[model samples]
Target: MLIIEGAGRWTTPTDGANDWVEHLRMPDLSVGTYCIPAGGLDDQSPHTEDEIYVVTAGQARIVTPDGATEVGPGSVIFVPAGEEHRFDEVTEDLALLVIFGPAYGSRAPAHPAPLRPRS
Candidate 1:
């Protein structure tokens, strides 16, 4: 069993206003806890792995190929591999629980890129 306090530790800066804490990670999958401050938008990039975001607090807008949608507490968002997506319109500092990987029945590669807002 994996356990994480994930309160003050595990924070990785997404940008100027956004930061995320890696609460859990394994060879098969990984889980992250994020905090998006007001007006935070992580760069839009293509993902090589499947990802799901569960909103824990506040609100955010997720922009994808299909379109954009508002995500808030109790809401969930999924992004398939190679999909262009981003987080925006963060209100009142958004907190999220992110999960992705082979742990979730996915066998995709990791395609990481520089964090840059989509233009």
Candidate 2:
């Protein structure tokens, strides 16, 4: 069994380094935790793989082609493959469980994942 003690340690105090902590890695999926500082900016651009964001703490606004939505603890957000998105208006340090299907750095499929958001 894989256990990552304290996901908060995932963030790096050092600059110019990846701060995400990957708790699991597989051929078709990966799970990780990331923390953005209060008032931090998300410089990330559109990605090739669909992603699901589970907000574990803090608050922010997520913007995409579909427009923006305020998100906070317990919020779940989805972004389609190749669709532009980013975080803004952060009021607190944001902690998230980020699931990247097929994982980043691995080859991505041409289509979005077949699964839909759970009701």
Query: What TM-score does model 2 achieve against the real structure?
Result: 0.77
- Give per-residue CA lDDT, model 1, range 4-117, as digits (tens): 666433244555657766666687787877776777767646656788888878777888879999888888887887788888887757777888774433454556887999
Give the TM-score comparing model 1 with the true structure, all chains together.
Answer: 0.73
Error at 10, model 1, angstroms: 11
Global local distance difference test of model 1: 0.72
Predicted candidate 2 versus true structure: per-residue lDDT over 1-119, tens digit per residue = 76766653335434633357777778888788877777778888777777888998888999988889999988988887788998888787788888888786466446776998889
Which has the greatest TM-score?
A: 2
Best by lDDT: 2
lDDT scores of the candidates, listed in order: 0.72, 0.77
After superposition, the stretches of candidate 1 with alpha carbons farther than 4 Å from their true spots are: 7-16, 103-119
**CA lDDT of 54 in candidate 1?**
83
